[model samples]
Target: MGSLDVIARALWSALLLCVISFSSPLRAQPEPIELWHGRVKADQPFLDKLFKQFTAETGIPVHLRYIIFKNLKVELIGAAFSNAMPDAIIAPADFLGHYKELKLPAIPDSEMPDTIRPRFLKTVELDGKRYGYPFFYGNNLMMFYNKSLVETPATSWKELRVMKPYYDKRNIELITFSYQEMYWLVPVIGAYGGWPLEGKKPMLNTPAVISAFKFYKGLVDEKLVQSDCNLQCSLLKFEQGKAAFLIDGTWSYKRLEESIGDDLGVAVLPYIDGKPMRPMYSSHVLAFPDYESQGEKQTKLDKLRDFIFRKDVQRQFYDEIGQIPTHKELASLVEHTTDPNRKAHFHQLEHARMMPIEPEMSHVWQSLIRGWERYSMHGFSAEESAVYMQKTVEREIERDTQ
Candidate 1:
């Protein structure tokens, strides 16, 4: 055991160790991509199965966290300030209103697939940049009636009033809806030739707005519509056949179908003064917060985005969850469906208007809700309430912008 021989043996061992380390680097495995959503527990099994397929195909893991729908924005802002944002979120189109606070990156046009329907594209695009990819659409309102009570659906508000006497004789209410909710009120405003927004500006104090308020009040005062009815009350009364007509969103279709079966009849919202009633429609979207800073993870998220738009994936969403796909090709198939209810939904969509996605819209909603409360409950004149809405929303917008 010469000293030179011992030194030579140590050198050989060190070289071999270096070669092994280089071949199999000690780099840590990446964490699973986190996605936040407000989907109900009933959707768990489907989402689990879908993500499982995604992971299997791409070798990337995903983790889903459910936040209550109402609190998602607040929680997201908290997470952002703490520098703990998730990889992505499945949010309603309104979430785009928080783009600046959340640092959500605009998805480049080239990255967006051509298959996305043009209408849905507008939901994600704010100003000149796109912020999200639409997953599914259809929050539009429609008219539903129990065919056993009403033989023919009315085509206009005047015609609907004509049926009140027939309904009175049968001891059935003519119609029921969420009279106090701004969402329902917005459509009536549209029917009266009013729109809440005119290219990012609020237009709440107009002749049409005052007329809409008066007309809505008249419906209650005349007993032409059920007063003091919330969504649940309306649904229950309609299901039990106490109410002959109901105005509800597309989301209620499955429940109504189950409750009334073959007796369920759906139609477009009735006209007001020869102009069609226009309901607001919106979509749930996939958004990436801090996307530009995702670094190495950006490529993986891109794959996930593209995967959601696959024809087979879109079809699965439609077939399983009854979500209308945002793909134009699939939407065309829905348009030609043989099912009567499906056809009715498409017809309603055709007549509906896209809801505004601007950040200012948040202020508008809050202001309108306050105005409606005063007009409907506090004995304020329709003109006064309309003026209050316009002034309140303007101040809120100015304050926030400054």
Candidate 2:
């Protein structure tokens, strides 16, 4: 009788334990920190290496989705509207304000370099809140010259003209930039103290800008710059020793180094009217989206803060991806590197200006290109082109506003 009672009690207790175990929740996996990156698939390995370190250090899982730069803004806008946005986005600084207007919270990172503060502040700050933190910031134009072609790089158009005979003797062009594209024309126009806009209003007809165009026309007239070449053709010419000087951004540093090796050199654009041709700079920044979950936001903020601000991490990006580091302390290291073929782009960056980030800017690119086409292909005089550019920009900008 005692054995039967004992056995029945033991069996009941085992069944109760089985029921409790079945009712309780299974072990839940850690949620991935959702991140959106505009890097292409070819960059997947590098991105994987970058994120692996962050995950290793924090034990936080990260899921990075590839979105190309061209589609980043529109797709992100759609995501914002649909409430399906990522916790963080790695994007060019151009859209910082746009994202801020979308109500993405900007978490302040006092760890950022003071050198980067002004640009970030100018782009993202409103009423004293910064909306983006600096990540890596060096895609601006500089002059790359082949030492074998010229003893020294020309310091001005005047010097370039005088040296033209040497290249001409060798059947080489003195300098062959993408003459038709207006994108790189800023430095030349800015050399004369003119820019495309004056605070959302078009300034294409500024006397300085007109003079800038005439100056280029003179170059074309002198046969110093090729009028018919695109960037690829010009770059090919430079690579083939058919040209000596090329104007391109820091993004080409490694490629040129690979092509020409130690013969390559980088310097600021030549001067005109005592002002250097200061190109506009573009940079990457860490931006956040307003997340519904506080924990997700915190996880993103923590991971980005931990990964981007480290001196070692910045150095790793510089070494591995050839991304110029924005941390002030790393600047000197890059500037002083054994590679004369490369310079810390920041020194030249100091003289450069930030592009207009306002909504009207979306209208300026196509309008200016069209104006240039009218002048070159439709027989508009310099004065006529200047006036046409002014009207077109204003009209397009007005349209954008409406």
Candidate 3:
């Protein structure tokens, strides 16, 4: 136990410890990527399984946080200001409108697939630079009818007009829809070849817009449509067999199927002035928040986007969630399946116009809806309603500018 013997023993022990640490084949693990999504609250099991696959294949672990869909933008903005934004965010397409202002990076074009944009990626793109890819689209509207009541679906507005009296005689209301809402009204407006906005100005007062209002009024006047129909009311009317036809979005299919059973038939909207009744559509998107485009985080984001959008993944999500595919290859397989109603839905979606994704779209929706309620439910004429819409929207725009 002399001083030299004690020192040698301590040195030998330290050397052995160093060798064991170096030979153990473990190093500092990289930080897990954080992803914020709103859908996990309801789809946690699906997301959990899909995410496990993502991690397994790429070896990039992720932390998924569920923010409420409505609050996602606010949360992301808060995160940005606090310098704690997640590595990525999964939000509805409208939320991406603030990406540039939030300093988020555009997804590299090379990493995006061309098949998706034609159908699903509609409003998510801005100024030719897309910020993200669509995860799923279920926003398009379609015509739902009772096959037992109506032997054949209406092919034109004129046909529906003619068939109304027959259905009325049978004690069935001809048609009904969520007529008070702007999203519901936008489809009819577009079908008549009118849109609510051109850039930032209101295009609510046009020949087509006036015609659409007139058409709506005619449906009410002829007793072919419920005058003040709304979501719950219309669904009730249709489900109870009080209404022969209902205009609803793709999301309403399951409920209708459950309520109406095998007699539930889906159809492309009847034509207007020789054109198909166009519907408004949109989807949720996956995006990155202010990450360097060529950096490590961006590379990981790229891989995630590419991986999630694969045809197999798209099919799996559609099978589980009933989201219509935007992938070219998968779209065919999904729509060509035995589900004729789903095929019809995809057909209508193909022709549907996507709702605008700009921040000003909020003002447009509210202004148009206010005017619509006045015109459709109250006694205001189409002209008077148009004037109100234009003025209200212009005032809102000016206020925003100020």
Candidate 4:
């Protein structure tokens, strides 16, 4: 045993240790949970604050990206094809229709926070599985009036029609709304005893649709509503006291309250010929995409979900933004609140129907808008327009399914 042999053995041992260290994998750092959403720009700050708080509490960082609502779906599909999809999406419940296409795994019902209202939870459930977390509900249209201009809100369209001449003489429109939006037209169809969707099928070619078209045109012909005005125009007219009433969705409540102050009065949609104007409503949801691929990231997402649905967090959603919270207790508070506007909103929700959650409902919307444009701008007869809508949507559904 010489000094040379002792040095060679030590060198060999060091070389082997270096090779093993280089070959073995080091522990990987946790990835930030990535989320994509189509919510309005105003929501970003509040959402950022929430995410920051979550990171502070759990040491798990979150990254968010905002995509335009119209473009969100196409991009999600594109990303899915490219294997570059985000971990989750916050979007309207209609995105549930893409659950299969996006390979979004069902969020076990047991994993869902019990604080969410049952009805809101149902929006994300299709067949028997829950695919998303219901964030908030109550996007529906109601009639809002200027109390100073109209002493009483009209409960019936016939009564509203009777007040047209009075408003005309005052050089003000009796009512105003975004005349071309198909969302607004759903209530009209409901008043005529039709729903655009009955399960997965669209009922656009019915007598109800024809009547709805004719009724809307009659309002324009009788000078009861301004057909040329868009939503912003109608909002401005109402704010400036130029219009006695406006029809709009819950999303505009805070803005209307700010603009009109005490003069803002909310009411359920006016009735037509003994039928109620059942406006369509829907919930916004937080959905996971290709969740099975997430592996250990699921645990972090679980914490994020719990944080997002916490009672305090849900309440902030209402307090900060005008978004209605989906927590049962908070929704009950709003339902029973002394605030007249909140009460009116709850009452409207009582009469409103949830928008069809089926993916095919998208076709109904596209077809209905086309039919409306034909009747309004192209001079197509109501019956013709109705027939066109039904045929078009059916064709689209068939083509898409195929």
Which candidate leads the pack in lDDT? 1
* CA lDDT for candidate 4: 0.86
lDDT of 3 at 10: 96
Query: In candidate 2, what are the lDDT values of residues 1-402, reduced to their tens digit?
Result: 999999999999999999999999998877777888785444567778888888888777789988866688888998888878887778776676575444566555564446553544564443456567766776678888888887878878788888989878889888888888776777888888888765666678788777777776777888989888987788888888889999877666666776887788777788885778868776777766774355645755666666777889888868766777777778667867776555435567777887766556656666677766776678888788888887888887776568
Distance (Å) between predicted and true CA of 193, model 2? Answer: 1.0
Cand. 3 Cα-lDDT? 0.78
Candidate 2 residue-wise lDDT at 153: 80
Q: Each candidate: what lDDT?
A: 0.87, 0.74, 0.78, 0.86
Model 1 clashing residue pairs (backbone): none
Candidate 3, which segments miss by more than 4 Å at Cα?
A: 1-49, 52-87, 101-103, 113-122, 161-173, 199-201, 217-223, 227-229, 236-242, 254-261, 292-303, 332-339, 377-379, 398-402
Candidates arranged by lDDT, highest first? 1, 4, 3, 2
Q: After superposition, how far is residue 342 of candidate 1 from its true place, in Å?
A: 1.7
lDDT per residue as tens, model 4, 1-402: 699999999999999999999999998866898999987665678889988999999989889999976799999989989989898788888788888887788887688889887878777877778888898988899999999999989999899988888988989889899987888888888887889998888999999899988888788787777778887798888889999999998777877887888989998889988888889888988888887877898898888888888888888988877788989898878667888877888888888988878888889989988998899889999999988989999999999989
Winner by lDDT between candidate 3 and candidate 1: 1
How does residue 65 of candidate 4 score in lDDT? 93
State every prediction's TM-score relative to the real structure: 0.85, 0.78, 0.74, 0.86
* Local lDDT at 190 for model 2: 85
Candidate 2 lDDT score at position 169:
86
Candidate 1 residue lDDT tens string, 118-197: 97888777998888899789888899999888788998889999999988998989999987778898888888888898
